[model samples]
Each structure stands twice: as structure tokens, then as C-alpha cells.
Target: MDSRSSDVSARQERGETGGWISTPVTTDLLRGALDLEHTEHGALPHRLPARARAQCSDGQLAMAEAQPSGVRLVLRTRATAVELDTLPTKVAYRGAPPGPDGVYDLLVDGHLVARTSVTGGNLRTVDMTTGSVETRTGPVGTARFSGLSAEPKELEIWLPHNEITQLVELRADAPVEAVPDRGRQVWLHHGSSISHGSDAASPTTTWPALAAFRGGVELINLGLGGSALLDPFTARALRDTPAELISVKLGINLVNADLMRLRAFTPAVHGFLDTVREGHPSTPLLVVSPIHCPIHEDTPGPSVPDFGDFEAGKLTFRAGGDPAERAAGKLTLNVIREELSRIVKQRAAEDPNLHHLDGRELYGEADTAELPLPDRLHPDAATHRRIGERFAERIFGTGGPFAARDD
Candidate 1:
């Protein structure tokens, strides 16, 4: 869709509709397109593979929760039929995500073909890397899907890394009428599940999506569930994208991974932003801390939900360090919080354009008392709404970080 069209669409959503075509998707017209729309019902979880749990592949460790909408009409080219050695000119629907954990259900012309979680979002565009491999797509993994033709294909997927009880009505290629192009900004956000809508009722309700709606920008959510580990490649991707407003929600992932001490984390963050600056230079950048998590409330410790509890059909986060271990480990939320405060202050001092917000400000100990994660690691849909509202209040508006000058 064109920017002119998107702006007009945004206006319509905002009740400022005019000068744009507002067309809803119809089943007939939708048949012509290849796409998937997230089920409008509720959140779904990705059932990770056993290998993922055992090997801890980065791809497995940094799980991205998403859902497949479904695949539509397949247009086969002569060359594609021979490449994969599948049925000549048959529609192929398969998923092959890295590390082979989650599964995506595939449908051909609304017919269920197969279900596997090893697939990832098709790369509509290529992202850059820190070391400079300029490909126009994400890494390709071996697909486990079978028998379907490898012709022109469209597949929809549900991308959660656990369960699907929350998944609502599954939607396939619904006719998406887009307005013509108009110049507009695209906002790119990177963070934990909060940014990924871990609790938001739907795909669009996530805070980044909400904020994008409020500000009128295109959203490219690079929210990986456990994936936002402050990788340099991720920062490189951010720097390389053409984003109007950029933010990196930092605290929770670092805390959860327990990857670094204060010594390593502080410098790593600075370096990440510095690399982003090399590309964005002056784009407004916001660094968000983690929202409330009681496990790390007072003291930081190994924060992971108990799998045994999950397997027993219970969802709970048992701080790896119990009271006795916490005392001995010298790990506590206070340590992490103090370090985060320092990181932000130092970064702000160095770069006027850089901004930071401690996650607690969004959901603090008090708020945690009222609202807690199901697994004590991720927030729920309601919490997501609250977080988005708070973020809009602070980051939107003319003098806010989102509203800051690019220069």
C-alpha cells in the first residue's frame, strides 16, 4: 500500500477519515491475494520442540511467538516446480523456523495441509547485519513441510512459543483494501513480549502497534519473545531500517538472560546505540527498561518460569534463586535497576537525542501487586493496554521522545 493511502487509512481509524478509499476485504476479492490475518479471537502460544529446550539454540532460546494466517492461491512458475522436487506445480505450505521449536499450521486454499513450527515470517524485505551481509531476506532454514507443490504460495501462521488456548478465530487471506501512497513515517520497535503483545488481546493491540496508531506511522515489530538479547546484529538491523521513531526496550531481556554483570551490560548498551547512531545518526531513540516483574523486584536472580510447573499444567515463574540462594548469589532486582539507571543517565549525557524510561514507571511494585504475569515473566493483555496507555502519555505529543527532532 502507498503512504498516501496509509495516512488516509490512519486518519479513518482515528475518525479523521476522508480523501481516502476505505474498503473492507471480501471473501471473493480476498481469494485473489496471498496473505494471512491473525485470528481475531485471542493470544496463542507456540509449542516449542524438545530439541529447543535441550540444545538452547539461539534461535530456540530467543523464541518469537507468531501465528500463521494460512496460505492462499498458489501460482506456480516452471522453475520453482523443479527446484524442491515436490509435486509438479502443486501448492506447498510448510514452516521451518530456525532451531526447529515452534510449529506453524499450513493450509492450502483453506484446506489444512500440514502443521509445523519451524517456519519464520517471510522476508518481504531484507535486513542488514553488523558485519555487512546485505541480503534481501531472513536466513533460510530447511522446511519440514511436505508433498505440497512449491509454486507461488501464501501461508499464514500463529507464532507463539507455548500454547494456543488464547487463539481466537483464525483468519486467512481476507481482502485487505489499502489506500494509495502518501509520504509517512514508519516506526520500528524492538523489545520483549510487551512490545510483541505478550498480553495484548490481538496482534494490533500491542503497545508499539497502539503507539503507532496514535502517532500515525507504519509499524515493523521486531519483537522477539526471548530474542531481544541486545545482539549487535539486531542493532544493525535497526540502524539500517528507515524508521521515523526507534526504541529499544532493554531491561527485562537482559535481566532474564542474566547474560552479563553490570560491568559488561553498561558498555554493551552504549555500543549498541552507538552502532545505531552510525546509521541513524540523529533519529530519535528511546531506551525502555523492563516493566514490573516481582521475581526481579528487589533482587535480580536467574529468572525463568518453572517448566515442571508448566508441564504439570501450571504456569508459574520460580525465581531460579530461592531466598537462600538469592542471599548467597548477591543477585537482586536492585542491582539490575541501579545499573539500568546508570546506563540511561550516562547515555543521555552523551547523546541528547537518546532517552530512557525505567520499566517500573510503566508497571512498578505497586502495579505488580495488582497485575502479575501468568508465568511471572510476561504480562497479560490487560497489562499490555495499561503499558501502551502509559507509554503514549509519556512518549507521544510534541515535546516527547517520539515527537523529538531527527537532527
Candidate 2:
């Protein structure tokens, strides 16, 4: 070998390396269809969830299906645990279901850190009985396991391991530096299907994720597909999560779910903000209404041609958004606009940090004229990009967010 190569080898031999190695440990990176099956009373009942859970929500299994096509195994005694294995600094186990109903108490070194609702919310679209690698939970969020002890904490899944259930999409993420050095003013966001990237091209391509990348900030995305009904637990989650900036995208999901009406929405929003402000007394909080969706923009309640299509006339709203739901109050875009503004304003008097962003501003009825959500409920990739750009410019501004990377 040349002297340069020899010298490089010598340095490597001398243990002077702090960068990626030419050869990555490919044994773990092998690609395959990973599916986590579910079990009833100790037997396979359905397929596993298809979407990924949140980052801090990563879980492992006592058993799992190997990378090779359909091969499965019981990892109890055979599997090796990484003793004090290095985990991502920014990540932590938020909620692990320890008992039945697929729920686990979350602990960071024996301290009950966070508790999550059981598989209770994922039943609509997720298959708890089948074996599939599904993203069943919300989007990314902010957190730090700054002082995690080297104790092995047990995590329980909703599935029965003794039977046919096995964990798939076994991911252990190591957080990457999207921004070099910054103040770390985190962003907390809660939204609906668009926010959840129901049909957005990729995970990273989601508007919230993209906006986070551009803003040079960490994000906690709680964008559920159809679950953004302003739940109390969700609001509590937001209230508990630490963030310098926060935003809640309301509308579309509410309109589609036909869950509530104007009256309840107003108070629920008030209570949601009230709880959030309890945690972040002066954090910059923004409440965003729905973006432009013509059918639902003018009307209330969302319906689709199918579970996924919206452009066709076959797609229409359910007879003026349920009467009981409406009796809760007619929650149209106009109502959401009026109420969201009023709610944020009420919160702002006590906390000057509160703010509001009309979703129509991001993508209004006019914008929808040119660009509409493909399936009536979810936006396409282009819509995501557009929203991200707008969000960056509006909320983040040219200052490149309140927190930015150091040169």
C-alpha cells in the first residue's frame, strides 16, 4: 500500500477515529418485509400495526420475526441484549404497555416517566391480530433521557408473545443532527390527518417534519389520522411535554370525524389551552384551523369517495355534519376560525405568548381551487411541501426560527 494508505491505517490502528467507518455493520441493516402479528388468548388473531409509533415510543419484544421472509423465532433465551447499549441521546421510552390491552407503564430508569392510552385508539385502521410492521402512534416530539441509568426496564406489548405474536419493524433510532448547534427551542404540534401524513409521500416529507427540519428545531408531532378530536389525554400530553413553541392544527379531522360541534369545541379548546399554559406559562402557542378543502371548506363534516379518495363527487360531507355533533355546535371552517381566534385571544390575555394561525392562510379555498387534498381528508406530497414552505416563512420567518444552528 502507498505511504498515505499506510499512514491512515496507522492512525486507525492507533485508535484515532470519530467518524463513520467505511464498512457499516450490515448484519442489522438487512432489508426485508417485517410484520408483527397479534394474538388473542395466546394465538394469532390479526396483523400488527402498519404505521410507526413516535420516536420516544420505540419498543422491543421478547420475540420477533427475523429479517428473512417468514422465519420467526422466540428470542427469550436465544436473543442477546445490548448491556448498557448506547441509545440515541434525544430518545427515550415514553409509554410501554406492561399489562393486557397492550399497555405498558413508561419508565426512565424506574421513574414513571410517561403513561399512554392503550391500543384503545389504534383499532380503527390498525390490525392488532395480524403480523405487520405498522406505524400505529403519533408523530415525533421533543424529549431527553438526559440521565438514564443502565437498568434494563421491561416493556410489554398488547400482543401475547407465547402465542404467534411477534414484534416487527424493530427500530432503534439514533437521533441525527439536523441542526449543528442551537438554543434547542423545541416545537410541540397537534393536528389532524394532514399533520399525520396519512398520504404524504414519506415520513420526513410530512409538513411538520419538514417545517421542523427547516426551522432547525426538535418536534413532537401528535398528528393522528382521524383522532384529532381534542381529547383530554392528548391535551394533557401537550401540557406535560416541554416546548418553547407550540401549535395545534384543528378542523379537517373534526369535520370528518363528526365528533363534536361548536359549543364543545370552544370549551374543549379552552381547556386544552388552559392545560397547555399551565405547563408553558409563556411559551409561544399557535392554534391553526383547517387548510383549504373545498367540500369541507364551505361545508362541515368530511366524507370521501372511499376511505382514501376525495376529488370525485362521490366524495361529499355527511348531511351537514351530524345534528347531535352539530348540536354540540356547527363546527364549520367559519366556526373553527371564529372560535379558535376567540379561544387563543382568551388565553393570550393571561399569557401574552399565545398566538393563532388560520389554516386558510396556509392553504385557503382559493389555494384549494388550484390544489386540493387528494383524498378529501389527506393532502398530497406537494401540499405538504407547500405547507412547510408557508409555515417556515410565516411562523419561523427569515430569522430562521427563534433557535438556529450556530455557524
What is candidate 2's lDDT per residue for 1-407, written digit by digit as tens?
73334434754795643332221212122111223333221112211123322212322211111111111111111111111111010111112222222212223321344332212222112222242334333211111122323333322111111122222222112211111223656777777657755445544556876787678665556665556677665676677766778888987767775677676777788887788778877777788888877666546664533322232222322324443444446666766787788877776777776777888778877776677665455667788898987897888875433434355
Best by TM-score: 1
Over 247-358, each residue of candidate 1 has an lDDT whose tens digit, in order, gives: 8887676666666666677778788888888888777888877776777765555565454543344445656655544444343556656666777788777678788878
Stretches of candidate 1 off by over 4 Å are: 1-57, 61-181, 307-312, 322-332, 404-407
| Candidate maximizing lDDT | 1
Clashes of each: 45, 29
Give candidate 2 misplaced runs (Cα > 4 Å). Answer: 1-183, 302-328, 399-407
lDDT (Cα atoms) of all candidates against the true structure: 0.52, 0.49
* Alpha-carbon RMSD, candidate 2: 15.8
